[model samples]
Target: MKKLLILVFLTLPMIAFAQTKPYLSIADAERITAAAEAKAKAEGWNVVIAILDDGGHLISLKRMDGVQIGSIDVAQAKAKSAVYFKRSTKIFEDVMKGEGGSRIATLPNAVGVEGGLPIFKDGIIVGSIGISGVTSAQDGIIAEAGVKGY
Candidate 1:
Protein backbone atom coordinates (compact mmCIF):
# COMPACT_ATOMS: atom_id res chain seq x y z
CA MET A 1 0.00 0.00 0.00
CA LYS A 2 2.80 2.41 0.82
CA LYS A 3 4.62 1.68 -2.47
CA LEU A 4 1.42 2.15 -4.46
CA LEU A 5 0.71 5.45 -2.73
CA ILE A 6 4.19 6.71 -3.49
CA LEU A 7 3.88 5.77 -7.15
CA VAL A 8 0.53 7.45 -7.44
CA PHE A 9 1.86 10.67 -5.97
CA LEU A 10 4.85 10.61 -8.31
CA THR A 11 2.74 10.17 -11.43
CA LEU A 12 -0.16 12.46 -10.56
CA PRO A 13 1.37 15.53 -12.11
CA MET A 14 2.16 13.69 -15.28
CA ILE A 15 -1.34 12.35 -15.46
CA ALA A 16 -2.81 15.81 -15.02
CA PHE A 17 -0.52 17.20 -17.69
CA ALA A 18 -1.66 14.58 -20.15
CA GLN A 19 -5.28 15.57 -19.67
CA THR A 20 -4.65 19.07 -20.99
CA LYS A 21 -3.53 19.77 -24.53
CA PRO A 22 -1.74 22.65 -26.14
CA TYR A 23 -4.13 23.53 -28.89
CA LEU A 24 -2.78 26.95 -29.82
CA SER A 25 0.68 27.41 -31.18
CA ILE A 26 2.71 30.49 -32.04
CA ALA A 27 1.99 29.93 -35.72
CA ASP A 28 -1.73 29.85 -35.07
CA ALA A 29 -1.55 33.10 -33.15
CA GLU A 30 0.33 34.76 -35.97
CA ARG A 31 -2.03 33.47 -38.59
CA ILE A 32 -5.03 34.61 -36.60
CA THR A 33 -3.49 38.03 -36.15
CA ALA A 34 -2.78 38.25 -39.86
CA ALA A 35 -6.34 37.34 -40.76
CA ALA A 36 -7.68 39.90 -38.31
CA GLU A 37 -5.42 42.59 -39.70
CA ALA A 38 -6.43 41.81 -43.27
CA LYS A 39 -10.10 41.92 -42.43
CA ALA A 40 -9.71 45.20 -40.57
CA LYS A 41 -7.90 46.75 -43.49
CA ALA A 42 -10.45 45.55 -45.99
CA GLU A 43 -13.28 46.84 -43.86
CA GLY A 44 -11.51 50.13 -43.07
CA TRP A 45 -11.85 49.45 -39.37
CA ASN A 46 -8.61 50.13 -37.61
CA VAL A 47 -8.13 48.29 -34.32
CA VAL A 48 -5.74 46.69 -31.90
CA ILE A 49 -5.65 42.93 -31.61
CA ALA A 50 -4.30 40.86 -28.74
CA ILE A 51 -3.90 37.10 -28.54
CA LEU A 52 -3.20 35.24 -25.31
CA ASP A 53 -2.09 31.71 -24.63
CA ASP A 54 -4.05 29.19 -22.57
CA GLY A 55 -2.32 30.51 -19.48
CA GLY A 56 -3.28 34.08 -20.32
CA HIS A 57 0.17 35.22 -21.35
CA LEU A 58 0.61 37.48 -24.33
CA ILE A 59 1.18 35.62 -27.55
CA SER A 60 0.78 38.35 -30.19
CA LEU A 61 -0.56 41.81 -30.64
CA LYS A 62 -1.14 44.20 -33.54
CA ARG A 63 -1.94 47.87 -33.57
CA MET A 64 -3.46 48.90 -36.84
CA ASP A 65 -2.76 52.08 -38.74
CA GLY A 66 -5.42 54.35 -37.28
CA VAL A 67 -6.29 52.71 -34.01
CA GLN A 68 -6.13 54.79 -30.87
CA ILE A 69 -3.02 54.04 -28.83
CA GLY A 70 -5.02 53.34 -25.69
CA SER A 71 -6.64 50.36 -27.33
CA ILE A 72 -3.59 48.17 -26.97
CA ASP A 73 -3.86 47.83 -23.21
CA VAL A 74 -7.59 47.25 -23.38
CA ALA A 75 -7.07 44.58 -25.99
CA GLN A 76 -4.55 42.74 -23.87
CA ALA A 77 -6.70 42.95 -20.76
CA LYS A 78 -9.69 41.56 -22.59
CA ALA A 79 -7.70 38.63 -23.91
CA LYS A 80 -6.16 37.87 -20.54
CA SER A 81 -9.55 38.00 -18.90
CA ALA A 82 -10.99 35.42 -21.25
CA VAL A 83 -8.01 33.10 -21.13
CA TYR A 84 -7.59 33.25 -17.37
CA PHE A 85 -11.26 33.08 -16.56
CA LYS A 86 -12.03 30.48 -19.21
CA ARG A 87 -15.18 32.22 -20.34
CA SER A 88 -16.37 35.10 -22.49
CA THR A 89 -15.47 38.56 -21.27
CA LYS A 90 -18.92 39.78 -22.20
CA ILE A 91 -20.42 37.40 -19.68
CA PHE A 92 -18.15 38.71 -16.97
CA GLU A 93 -18.95 42.28 -17.90
CA ASP A 94 -22.60 41.70 -17.30
CA VAL A 95 -22.09 39.72 -14.12
CA MET A 96 -19.68 42.21 -12.64
CA LYS A 97 -22.12 45.03 -13.10
CA GLY A 98 -24.89 43.24 -11.32
CA GLU A 99 -25.87 43.49 -7.65
CA GLY A 100 -22.69 41.73 -6.55
CA GLY A 101 -20.59 43.83 -8.88
CA SER A 102 -17.87 44.62 -6.39
CA ARG A 103 -17.53 41.05 -5.23
CA ILE A 104 -17.39 39.71 -8.76
CA ALA A 105 -14.75 42.24 -9.76
CA THR A 106 -12.54 41.18 -6.89
CA LEU A 107 -11.77 37.77 -8.35
CA PRO A 108 -8.07 37.46 -9.10
CA ASN A 109 -7.22 38.12 -12.75
CA ALA A 110 -10.84 38.50 -13.63
CA VAL A 111 -11.71 41.18 -16.14
CA GLY A 112 -15.19 42.46 -16.69
CA VAL A 113 -15.51 43.80 -20.18
CA GLU A 114 -16.15 42.91 -23.76
CA GLY A 115 -13.93 42.23 -26.79
CA GLY A 116 -12.50 38.91 -25.58
CA LEU A 117 -13.37 35.65 -27.33
CA PRO A 118 -11.98 32.23 -26.57
CA ILE A 119 -10.05 30.50 -29.34
CA PHE A 120 -11.09 26.90 -29.57
CA LYS A 121 -9.12 24.23 -31.37
CA ASP A 122 -10.82 20.86 -31.84
CA GLY A 123 -13.58 21.93 -29.46
CA ILE A 124 -11.07 22.72 -26.73
CA ILE A 125 -10.42 26.28 -25.61
CA VAL A 126 -6.70 26.68 -25.95
CA GLY A 127 -6.50 30.44 -25.96
CA SER A 128 -8.39 33.63 -26.58
CA ILE A 129 -8.34 36.66 -28.91
CA GLY A 130 -9.28 40.23 -28.12
CA ILE A 131 -9.91 43.25 -30.33
CA SER A 132 -10.16 46.88 -29.34
CA GLY A 133 -10.59 50.36 -30.92
CA VAL A 134 -14.23 49.85 -31.82
CA THR A 135 -17.54 49.04 -30.21
CA SER A 136 -17.89 45.69 -28.45
CA ALA A 137 -20.00 44.36 -31.31
CA GLN A 138 -17.34 45.30 -33.82
CA ASP A 139 -14.71 43.78 -31.60
CA GLY A 140 -16.65 40.52 -31.60
CA ILE A 141 -16.81 40.58 -35.37
CA ILE A 142 -13.10 41.17 -35.72
CA ALA A 143 -12.24 38.43 -33.23
CA GLU A 144 -14.67 36.03 -34.92
CA ALA A 145 -12.96 36.67 -38.25
CA GLY A 146 -9.70 35.45 -36.79
CA VAL A 147 -11.30 32.42 -35.15
CA LYS A 148 -12.69 31.07 -38.46
CA GLY A 149 -9.48 29.33 -39.45
CA TYR A 150 -9.22 27.55 -36.14
Candidate 2:
Protein backbone atom coordinates (compact mmCIF):
# COMPACT_ATOMS: atom_id res chain seq x y z
CA MET A 1 0.00 0.00 0.00
CA LYS A 2 2.82 2.42 0.82
CA LYS A 3 4.60 1.57 -2.45
CA LEU A 4 1.40 2.13 -4.37
CA LEU A 5 0.95 5.58 -2.76
CA ILE A 6 4.54 6.53 -3.60
CA LEU A 7 4.16 5.49 -7.23
CA VAL A 8 0.94 7.47 -7.53
CA PHE A 9 2.58 10.60 -6.15
CA LEU A 10 5.59 10.23 -8.46
CA THR A 11 3.57 9.68 -11.62
CA LEU A 12 0.91 12.28 -10.99
CA PRO A 13 3.08 15.16 -12.18
CA MET A 14 3.90 13.44 -15.44
CA ILE A 15 0.25 12.77 -16.15
CA ALA A 16 -0.70 16.33 -15.32
CA PHE A 17 2.07 17.70 -17.49
CA ALA A 18 1.03 15.65 -20.48
CA GLN A 19 -2.47 17.07 -20.25
CA THR A 20 -1.15 20.56 -20.82
CA LYS A 21 -1.17 21.55 -24.45
CA PRO A 22 1.44 23.55 -26.37
CA TYR A 23 0.09 26.73 -27.89
CA LEU A 24 1.74 29.36 -30.08
CA SER A 25 3.02 32.30 -28.04
CA ILE A 26 2.20 35.92 -28.83
CA ALA A 27 5.67 36.48 -30.30
CA ASP A 28 5.08 33.63 -32.68
CA ALA A 29 1.81 35.21 -33.78
CA GLU A 30 3.50 38.56 -34.31
CA ARG A 31 6.23 37.00 -36.40
CA ILE A 32 3.67 35.29 -38.57
CA THR A 33 1.61 38.49 -38.87
CA ALA A 34 4.63 40.63 -39.68
CA ALA A 35 5.87 38.26 -42.33
CA ALA A 36 2.44 37.93 -43.89
CA GLU A 37 1.68 41.63 -43.69
CA ALA A 38 4.92 42.51 -45.40
CA LYS A 39 4.05 40.21 -48.26
CA ALA A 40 0.54 41.66 -48.54
CA LYS A 41 1.79 45.22 -48.39
CA ALA A 42 4.07 44.51 -51.30
CA GLU A 43 0.98 43.81 -53.32
CA GLY A 44 -0.89 46.77 -51.81
CA TRP A 45 -3.56 44.66 -50.17
CA ASN A 46 -4.86 45.68 -46.78
CA VAL A 47 -5.58 42.58 -44.73
CA VAL A 48 -6.90 41.47 -41.39
CA ILE A 49 -5.30 38.43 -39.83
CA ALA A 50 -6.50 36.00 -37.21
CA ILE A 51 -4.85 33.16 -35.33
CA LEU A 52 -6.76 30.57 -33.37
CA ASP A 53 -5.79 27.68 -31.13
CA ASP A 54 -6.37 24.00 -31.84
CA GLY A 55 -9.53 24.23 -29.82
CA GLY A 56 -10.67 27.03 -32.15
CA HIS A 57 -10.20 29.84 -29.68
CA LEU A 58 -8.80 33.15 -30.88
CA ILE A 59 -5.21 33.66 -29.76
CA SER A 60 -4.13 36.80 -31.58
CA LEU A 61 -5.43 39.01 -34.37
CA LYS A 62 -4.38 42.08 -36.31
CA ARG A 63 -5.56 44.48 -38.97
CA MET A 64 -3.20 46.26 -41.26
CA ASP A 65 -3.48 49.82 -42.58
CA GLY A 66 -6.74 50.68 -44.38
CA VAL A 67 -8.49 47.38 -43.57
CA GLN A 68 -12.22 47.60 -43.03
CA ILE A 69 -13.57 47.46 -39.48
CA GLY A 70 -15.91 44.52 -40.12
CA SER A 71 -13.03 42.45 -41.40
CA ILE A 72 -11.87 41.89 -37.84
CA ASP A 73 -14.80 39.79 -36.60
CA VAL A 74 -15.20 38.02 -39.92
CA ALA A 75 -11.53 37.14 -39.98
CA GLN A 76 -11.60 35.69 -36.48
CA ALA A 77 -14.74 33.75 -37.23
CA LYS A 78 -13.19 32.37 -40.38
CA ALA A 79 -10.12 31.28 -38.41
CA LYS A 80 -12.13 29.67 -35.64
CA SER A 81 -14.25 27.94 -38.23
CA ALA A 82 -11.14 26.62 -39.93
CA VAL A 83 -9.56 25.37 -36.71
CA TYR A 84 -12.72 23.65 -35.61
CA PHE A 85 -13.48 22.26 -39.03
CA LYS A 86 -9.89 21.21 -39.65
CA ARG A 87 -9.89 22.15 -43.33
CA SER A 88 -9.96 25.16 -45.59
CA THR A 89 -13.19 27.01 -45.15
CA LYS A 90 -13.19 27.37 -48.90
CA ILE A 91 -13.50 23.61 -49.24
CA PHE A 92 -16.72 23.62 -47.31
CA GLU A 93 -18.05 26.46 -49.38
CA ASP A 94 -17.13 24.69 -52.57
CA VAL A 95 -18.63 21.42 -51.44
CA MET A 96 -21.78 22.88 -49.99
CA LYS A 97 -22.43 25.78 -52.30
CA GLY A 98 -25.29 25.66 -54.84
CA GLU A 99 -26.92 22.32 -54.20
CA GLY A 100 -26.15 21.82 -50.53
CA GLY A 101 -23.57 24.51 -49.89
CA SER A 102 -26.00 27.02 -48.55
CA ARG A 103 -27.47 24.45 -46.18
CA ILE A 104 -24.09 23.40 -44.82
CA ALA A 105 -23.17 27.05 -44.46
CA THR A 106 -26.06 27.36 -42.07
CA LEU A 107 -24.64 24.74 -39.75
CA PRO A 108 -23.56 25.83 -36.32
CA ASN A 109 -20.03 27.23 -36.16
CA ALA A 110 -19.76 26.70 -39.88
CA VAL A 111 -18.33 29.74 -41.53
CA GLY A 112 -18.22 28.24 -44.98
CA VAL A 113 -17.32 31.66 -46.20
CA GLU A 114 -13.69 32.01 -47.18
CA GLY A 115 -10.18 33.05 -46.10
CA GLY A 116 -9.66 30.24 -43.62
CA LEU A 117 -6.85 27.71 -43.58
CA PRO A 118 -5.50 25.21 -41.10
CA ILE A 119 -2.10 25.89 -39.53
CA PHE A 120 0.02 22.79 -39.51
CA LYS A 121 3.28 22.13 -37.65
CA ASP A 122 5.28 18.94 -38.07
CA GLY A 123 2.21 17.38 -39.72
CA ILE A 124 -0.06 18.19 -36.80
CA ILE A 125 -2.71 20.87 -36.87
CA VAL A 126 -1.65 23.37 -34.26
CA GLY A 127 -4.08 26.11 -35.17
CA SER A 128 -5.67 28.04 -38.02
CA ILE A 129 -5.18 31.28 -39.94
CA GLY A 130 -7.79 33.62 -41.41
CA ILE A 131 -7.39 36.72 -43.50
CA SER A 132 -9.82 39.31 -44.78
CA GLY A 133 -10.24 42.89 -46.15
CA VAL A 134 -9.26 41.88 -49.66
CA THR A 135 -10.74 39.44 -52.09
CA SER A 136 -11.04 35.91 -50.68
CA ALA A 137 -8.39 34.80 -53.14
CA GLN A 138 -6.04 37.52 -51.99
CA ASP A 139 -6.79 36.70 -48.37
CA GLY A 140 -5.80 33.11 -49.07
CA ILE A 141 -2.50 34.16 -50.54
CA ILE A 142 -1.69 36.31 -47.53
CA ALA A 143 -2.56 33.53 -45.11
CA GLU A 144 -0.35 31.14 -47.04
CA ALA A 145 2.68 33.33 -46.42
CA GLY A 146 2.14 33.07 -42.67
CA VAL A 147 1.78 29.29 -42.73
CA LYS A 148 5.32 28.97 -44.10
CA GLY A 149 6.53 29.32 -40.53
CA TYR A 150 4.90 26.00 -39.73
Candidate 3:
Protein backbone atom coordinates (compact mmCIF):
# COMPACT_ATOMS: atom_id res chain seq x y z
CA MET A 1 0.00 0.00 0.00
CA LYS A 2 2.84 2.43 0.73
CA LYS A 3 4.46 1.75 -2.64
CA LEU A 4 1.16 2.12 -4.44
CA LEU A 5 0.47 5.43 -2.71
CA ILE A 6 3.95 6.69 -3.60
CA LEU A 7 3.41 5.69 -7.21
CA VAL A 8 0.08 7.47 -7.32
CA PHE A 9 1.63 10.68 -6.00
CA LEU A 10 4.45 10.51 -8.52
CA THR A 11 2.10 10.02 -11.46
CA LEU A 12 -0.42 12.66 -10.50
CA PRO A 13 1.61 15.63 -11.70
CA MET A 14 2.52 13.83 -14.92
CA ILE A 15 -1.11 13.20 -15.68
CA ALA A 16 -2.11 16.76 -14.84
CA PHE A 17 0.68 18.23 -16.96
CA ALA A 18 0.05 15.95 -19.89
CA GLN A 19 -1.89 18.65 -21.63
CA THR A 20 0.92 20.86 -22.92
CA LYS A 21 -1.38 23.21 -24.70
CA PRO A 22 0.17 26.63 -25.24
CA TYR A 23 -1.58 29.82 -24.26
CA LEU A 24 -2.86 32.12 -26.99
CA SER A 25 -0.87 35.29 -27.55
CA ILE A 26 -2.52 38.62 -28.17
CA ALA A 27 -1.24 38.59 -31.74
CA ASP A 28 -2.67 35.13 -32.29
CA ALA A 29 -6.02 36.19 -30.93
CA GLU A 30 -6.02 39.25 -33.20
CA ARG A 31 -5.22 37.11 -36.20
CA ILE A 32 -8.05 34.74 -35.36
CA THR A 33 -10.50 37.58 -35.05
CA ALA A 34 -9.40 39.02 -38.38
CA ALA A 35 -9.76 35.70 -40.14
CA ALA A 36 -13.23 35.16 -38.70
CA GLU A 37 -14.34 38.65 -39.61
CA ALA A 38 -13.08 38.23 -43.15
CA LYS A 39 -15.04 35.06 -43.54
CA ALA A 40 -18.22 36.60 -42.20
CA LYS A 41 -17.82 39.59 -44.50
CA ALA A 42 -17.12 37.38 -47.49
CA GLU A 43 -20.31 35.47 -46.83
CA GLY A 44 -22.22 38.72 -46.19
CA TRP A 45 -23.22 37.38 -42.82
CA ASN A 46 -23.02 40.06 -40.18
CA VAL A 47 -22.02 38.40 -36.94
CA VAL A 48 -20.35 38.73 -33.58
CA ILE A 49 -17.16 36.77 -33.01
CA ALA A 50 -15.33 36.01 -29.76
CA ILE A 51 -11.99 34.43 -28.97
CA LEU A 52 -11.15 32.95 -25.59
CA ASP A 53 -8.08 31.44 -24.00
CA ASP A 54 -7.99 27.87 -22.71
CA GLY A 55 -9.22 29.02 -19.31
CA GLY A 56 -12.34 30.67 -20.75
CA HIS A 57 -10.92 34.18 -20.55
CA LEU A 58 -11.98 36.44 -23.39
CA ILE A 59 -9.13 37.40 -25.65
CA SER A 60 -11.02 39.39 -28.21
CA LEU A 61 -14.54 40.16 -29.37
CA LYS A 62 -15.97 41.81 -32.47
CA ARG A 63 -19.48 42.78 -33.38
CA MET A 64 -20.00 43.37 -37.05
CA ASP A 65 -22.41 45.82 -38.57
CA GLY A 66 -26.12 44.92 -38.45
CA VAL A 67 -25.55 42.21 -35.86
CA GLN A 68 -27.98 41.98 -32.99
CA ILE A 69 -26.68 43.23 -29.65
CA GLY A 70 -27.63 40.02 -27.92
CA SER A 71 -25.13 38.16 -30.08
CA ILE A 72 -22.28 39.72 -28.15
CA ASP A 73 -23.18 37.87 -24.98
CA VAL A 74 -24.06 34.68 -26.83
CA ALA A 75 -20.75 34.59 -28.66
CA GLN A 76 -18.78 35.01 -25.44
CA ALA A 77 -20.81 32.31 -23.74
CA LYS A 78 -20.18 29.91 -26.59
CA ALA A 79 -16.45 30.58 -26.53
CA LYS A 80 -16.40 30.10 -22.78
CA SER A 81 -18.12 26.76 -23.14
CA ALA A 82 -15.72 25.58 -25.83
CA VAL A 83 -12.56 26.51 -23.94
CA TYR A 84 -13.77 25.30 -20.55
CA PHE A 85 -15.06 21.98 -21.91
CA LYS A 86 -12.28 21.54 -24.49
CA ARG A 87 -14.83 20.69 -27.15
CA SER A 88 -17.13 22.30 -29.66
CA THR A 89 -20.36 23.76 -28.42
CA LYS A 90 -22.08 21.68 -31.08
CA ILE A 91 -21.47 18.59 -28.98
CA PHE A 92 -23.32 20.08 -26.06
CA GLU A 93 -26.07 21.31 -28.34
CA ASP A 94 -26.59 17.83 -29.71
CA VAL A 95 -26.47 16.26 -26.27
CA MET A 96 -28.96 18.77 -24.97
CA LYS A 97 -31.45 17.58 -27.54
CA GLY A 98 -31.36 14.06 -26.11
CA GLU A 99 -33.37 12.69 -23.17
CA GLY A 100 -30.88 13.92 -20.54
CA GLY A 101 -29.98 17.18 -22.28
CA SER A 102 -31.80 19.29 -19.78
CA ARG A 103 -29.19 18.48 -17.15
CA ILE A 104 -26.53 20.29 -19.12
CA ALA A 105 -28.64 23.41 -19.11
CA THR A 106 -27.94 23.80 -15.40
CA LEU A 107 -24.22 24.11 -15.92
CA PRO A 108 -22.98 27.66 -15.41
CA ASN A 109 -21.94 29.55 -18.55
CA ALA A 110 -22.78 26.53 -20.65
CA VAL A 111 -24.00 27.59 -24.08
CA GLY A 112 -25.03 24.64 -26.17
CA VAL A 113 -24.76 25.93 -29.72
CA GLU A 114 -23.02 25.23 -33.03
CA GLY A 115 -20.84 28.32 -33.35
CA GLY A 116 -18.05 27.43 -30.91
CA LEU A 117 -14.90 25.48 -31.77
CA PRO A 118 -11.79 24.55 -29.82
CA ILE A 119 -8.54 25.74 -31.33
CA PHE A 120 -6.02 22.94 -31.42
CA LYS A 121 -2.26 22.98 -31.98
CA ASP A 122 -0.29 19.78 -32.18
CA GLY A 123 -3.36 17.89 -30.98
CA ILE A 124 -3.57 20.15 -27.93
CA ILE A 125 -6.40 22.56 -27.38
CA VAL A 126 -5.00 26.09 -26.98
CA GLY A 127 -8.07 28.24 -27.19
CA SER A 128 -11.50 28.57 -28.77
CA ILE A 129 -13.61 30.77 -31.02
CA GLY A 130 -17.31 31.53 -31.01
CA ILE A 131 -19.46 33.31 -33.58
CA SER A 132 -23.06 34.47 -33.42
CA GLY A 133 -25.57 36.80 -35.16
CA VAL A 134 -26.30 34.60 -38.16
CA THR A 135 -27.68 31.09 -38.15
CA SER A 136 -25.84 28.51 -36.08
CA ALA A 137 -24.47 26.81 -39.20
CA GLN A 138 -23.23 30.06 -40.64
CA ASP A 139 -21.72 31.06 -37.32
CA GLY A 140 -19.90 27.74 -37.16
CA ILE A 141 -18.47 28.28 -40.63
CA ILE A 142 -17.10 31.65 -39.63
CA ALA A 143 -15.65 30.27 -36.40
CA GLU A 144 -13.99 27.49 -38.36
CA ALA A 145 -12.30 30.08 -40.55
CA GLY A 146 -10.87 31.72 -37.44
CA VAL A 147 -9.69 28.47 -35.93
CA LYS A 148 -7.83 27.68 -39.16
CA GLY A 149 -5.51 30.59 -38.40
CA TYR A 150 -4.54 29.32 -34.96
Candidate 4:
Protein backbone atom coordinates (compact mmCIF):
# COMPACT_ATOMS: atom_id res chain seq x y z
CA MET A 1 0.00 0.00 0.00
CA LYS A 2 2.84 2.41 0.81
CA LYS A 3 4.52 1.67 -2.56
CA LEU A 4 1.17 2.28 -4.34
CA LEU A 5 0.82 5.64 -2.59
CA ILE A 6 4.36 6.62 -3.61
CA LEU A 7 3.66 5.67 -7.21
CA VAL A 8 0.45 7.73 -7.20
CA PHE A 9 2.32 10.75 -5.90
CA LEU A 10 4.99 10.34 -8.55
CA THR A 11 2.33 10.47 -11.28
CA LEU A 12 0.24 13.25 -9.80
CA PRO A 13 2.10 16.10 -11.48
CA MET A 14 1.86 14.46 -14.86
CA ILE A 15 -1.88 14.01 -14.52
CA ALA A 16 -2.31 17.63 -13.43
CA PHE A 17 -0.27 18.91 -16.34
CA ALA A 18 -2.15 16.73 -18.81
CA GLN A 19 -5.36 18.69 -18.50
CA THR A 20 -6.34 19.87 -21.94
CA LYS A 21 -5.81 23.51 -22.65
CA PRO A 22 -8.48 25.48 -24.47
CA TYR A 23 -7.89 25.45 -28.17
CA LEU A 24 -9.72 26.90 -31.16
CA SER A 25 -11.14 24.07 -33.22
CA ILE A 26 -11.98 24.31 -36.91
CA ALA A 27 -15.67 24.61 -36.10
CA ASP A 28 -14.97 27.45 -33.71
CA ALA A 29 -12.94 29.22 -36.37
CA GLU A 30 -15.77 28.79 -38.85
CA ARG A 31 -18.30 30.15 -36.41
CA ILE A 32 -16.13 33.21 -35.73
CA THR A 33 -15.69 33.82 -39.44
CA ALA A 34 -19.41 33.52 -40.05
CA ALA A 35 -20.19 36.07 -37.37
CA ALA A 36 -17.67 38.56 -38.74
CA GLU A 37 -18.92 37.97 -42.25
CA ALA A 38 -22.49 38.63 -41.20
CA LYS A 39 -21.50 41.91 -39.62
CA ALA A 40 -19.62 42.98 -42.71
CA LYS A 41 -22.50 42.09 -44.97
CA ALA A 42 -24.97 43.93 -42.81
CA GLU A 43 -22.79 46.99 -42.97
CA GLY A 44 -22.44 46.64 -46.74
CA TRP A 45 -18.71 46.30 -46.30
CA ASN A 46 -16.64 44.14 -48.58
CA VAL A 47 -13.87 42.66 -46.49
CA VAL A 48 -11.50 39.82 -45.77
CA ILE A 49 -11.52 37.91 -42.53
CA ALA A 50 -8.69 35.81 -41.11
CA ILE A 51 -8.61 33.51 -38.12
CA LEU A 52 -5.43 32.34 -36.41
CA ASP A 53 -4.93 29.77 -33.69
CA ASP A 54 -3.31 30.65 -30.38
CA GLY A 55 0.07 29.79 -31.82
CA GLY A 56 -0.51 32.35 -34.59
CA HIS A 57 -1.26 29.72 -37.17
CA LEU A 58 -3.88 30.39 -39.81
CA ILE A 59 -7.06 28.46 -39.23
CA SER A 60 -9.43 30.01 -41.74
CA LEU A 61 -9.74 32.88 -44.18
CA LYS A 62 -12.72 34.32 -46.02
CA ARG A 63 -12.78 37.07 -48.58
CA MET A 64 -16.04 38.67 -49.55
CA ASP A 65 -16.74 39.37 -53.21
CA GLY A 66 -15.36 42.65 -54.52
CA VAL A 67 -12.87 43.04 -51.71
CA GLN A 68 -9.41 44.08 -52.76
CA ILE A 69 -6.90 41.27 -53.09
CA GLY A 70 -4.46 43.06 -50.84
CA SER A 71 -6.79 42.63 -47.89
CA ILE A 72 -6.14 38.92 -47.77
CA ASP A 73 -2.56 39.31 -46.59
CA VAL A 74 -3.47 42.27 -44.45
CA ALA A 75 -6.09 40.26 -42.62
CA GLN A 76 -3.64 37.49 -41.87
CA ALA A 77 -1.01 39.91 -40.68
CA LYS A 78 -3.46 41.52 -38.30
CA ALA A 79 -4.43 38.17 -36.84
CA LYS A 80 -0.81 37.20 -36.39
CA SER A 81 -0.07 40.52 -34.78
CA ALA A 82 -2.85 39.98 -32.27
CA VAL A 83 -1.53 36.55 -31.39
CA TYR A 84 2.09 37.70 -31.16
CA PHE A 85 1.19 40.63 -28.97
CA LYS A 86 -1.54 38.88 -27.03
CA ARG A 87 -3.86 41.86 -27.43
CA SER A 88 -5.95 43.73 -29.98
CA THR A 89 -4.14 45.11 -33.01
CA LYS A 90 -5.92 48.35 -32.26
CA ILE A 91 -3.56 48.81 -29.34
CA PHE A 92 -0.67 48.98 -31.76
CA GLU A 93 -2.63 51.40 -33.87
CA ASP A 94 -3.16 53.60 -30.86
CA VAL A 95 0.48 53.38 -29.95
CA MET A 96 1.50 54.40 -33.42
CA LYS A 97 -0.24 57.70 -32.86
CA GLY A 98 1.92 58.42 -29.86
CA GLU A 99 5.50 59.68 -29.76
CA GLY A 100 8.12 56.95 -30.29
CA GLY A 101 5.37 54.69 -31.61
CA SER A 102 7.02 54.52 -35.01
CA ARG A 103 9.22 51.84 -33.52
CA ILE A 104 6.20 49.57 -33.63
CA ALA A 105 6.59 49.45 -37.37
CA THR A 106 9.94 47.73 -36.93
CA LEU A 107 8.49 44.86 -34.95
CA PRO A 108 8.34 41.78 -37.14
CA ASN A 109 4.78 40.63 -37.90
CA ALA A 110 3.38 43.43 -35.79
CA VAL A 111 0.56 45.13 -37.63
CA GLY A 112 -0.56 48.43 -36.19
CA VAL A 113 -4.11 48.04 -37.41
CA GLU A 114 -7.53 48.35 -35.82
CA GLY A 115 -9.18 45.14 -36.90
CA GLY A 116 -7.36 42.38 -35.06
CA LEU A 117 -8.82 40.92 -31.89
CA PRO A 118 -7.85 38.06 -29.60
CA ILE A 119 -10.43 35.35 -28.98
CA PHE A 120 -10.56 34.08 -25.43
CA LYS A 121 -12.27 31.10 -23.86
CA ASP A 122 -12.57 30.99 -20.09
CA GLY A 123 -10.11 33.86 -19.82
CA ILE A 124 -7.48 32.05 -21.86
CA ILE A 125 -6.57 33.13 -25.37
CA VAL A 126 -7.73 30.53 -27.85
CA GLY A 127 -7.12 32.38 -31.08
CA SER A 128 -7.54 35.67 -32.92
CA ILE A 129 -9.58 37.17 -35.74
CA GLY A 130 -8.70 39.93 -38.18
CA ILE A 131 -10.67 41.85 -40.78
CA SER A 132 -9.62 44.15 -43.58
CA GLY A 133 -10.87 46.07 -46.69
CA VAL A 134 -13.07 48.64 -44.94
CA THR A 135 -12.00 51.58 -42.84
CA SER A 136 -9.99 50.59 -39.79
CA ALA A 137 -12.79 51.47 -37.42
CA GLN A 138 -15.33 49.57 -39.48
CA ASP A 139 -13.10 46.51 -39.57
CA GLY A 140 -12.73 46.75 -35.82
CA ILE A 141 -16.48 46.81 -35.43
CA ILE A 142 -16.82 43.67 -37.50
CA ALA A 143 -14.07 41.94 -35.57
CA GLU A 144 -15.77 42.85 -32.31
CA ALA A 145 -18.97 41.27 -33.51
CA GLY A 146 -17.06 38.11 -34.37
CA VAL A 147 -15.43 37.83 -30.94
CA LYS A 148 -18.83 38.39 -29.37
CA GLY A 149 -20.18 35.43 -31.27
CA TYR A 150 -17.45 33.22 -29.89
**Best lDDT goes to which candidate?**
4
lDDT of each: 0.84, 0.82, 0.89, 0.93
Show the lowest summed lDDT stretch of 10 residues, model 3. 17-26
RMSD of every candidate to native, in Å, equals 5.5, 3.0, 7.4, 3.3
Kindly report which residue stretches of model 2 are placed more than 4 angstroms away from their true locations once superposed: 1-11, 18-22
TM-score of 2: 0.83
lDDT of 1 by residue, 12-93 (tens): 9999888466578889999999888777777889999999888888888899887898999999988988887778788887
* Candidate 4 TM-score to native: 0.87
lDDT of 2 by residue, 1-150 (tens): 999999999999999888454566677777778877887889999989998878888788888878889999989988888888788888876877667567876777778766888887656677898998998878888888887754
- Alpha-carbon shift of residue 138 in model 3 (angstroms): 0.9
Cα lDDT tens digits, model 4, 12-119, are: 999999859999999999999999999999989999999999999999999999999999999999999998888999999999999999999999988998999999
Instruction: Give per-model TM-scores.
Output: 0.77, 0.83, 0.82, 0.87
**Over 4 Å off, model 4:** 1-19
User: In model 4, which range of ten residues has the least summed lDDT?
Assistant: 16-25
- In model 3, what is the error at residue 73, expressed in angstroms? 0.6
